[model samples]
Target: MLRSLDVLLLIFLLVTAIGVVCTKDLLGAAIIFSAYSFTMAIVWQQLGAPDLALTEAAVGAGVTTVLFLIAISRTVRREDE
Candidate 1:
């Protein structure tokens, strides 16, 4: 069950990462990146590194996502043609 959960989390991380890279909208990409970071935090937790998982969640998902959202709010949401 644990291994299966890990696999599922990893798959979500991969899909979110790909979505982040493939997204055309900057805001959407930022959102997906945040999801990727959150999924990574879960993976770290499942791997038995609680400290790393907390740090990843706080910094990678929380702080980084906030920063990205702030930047996105100040700029255009879409790429210029």
Candidate 2:
């Protein structure tokens, strides 16, 4: 049962990763990336690595997402053709 949950999380992570890459909107991509990072943190926690999970939450989901949002806000929203 636990292993199945882990597998589900992995699948979610993969989907979020693809969403991040495939989305044309920068803000949407950043949000999806944050979701990906959060899923990774959950996986790390489930794998018995609280420290790694905390790091991922702080760095990947927290700092990186904030930075991406800030950068996106500072720049234009639409992709240039």
- For this target, which candidate reaches the highest TM-score against the unseen true structure? 2
Error of 2 at 39 (Å): 0.2
Question: What number of clashing residue pairs does each candidate have, in the order they appear?
Answer: 0, 0
Tens digit of per-residue lDDT, candidate 1, span 2-74: 6888888988989999999899998889989988998998898889999999999999999999999998899
Off by over 4 Å in 2: none
lDDT of each: 0.89, 0.93
Error of 2 at 69 (Å): 0.5
Instruction: Give lDDT tens digits, candidate 2, residues 1-81.
Output: 579999999999999999988988889999999999999999999999999999999999999999999988999665452
TM-score of 2: 0.91
The C-alpha RMSD of each candidate to the native structure, in angstroms, is 1.8, 1.7
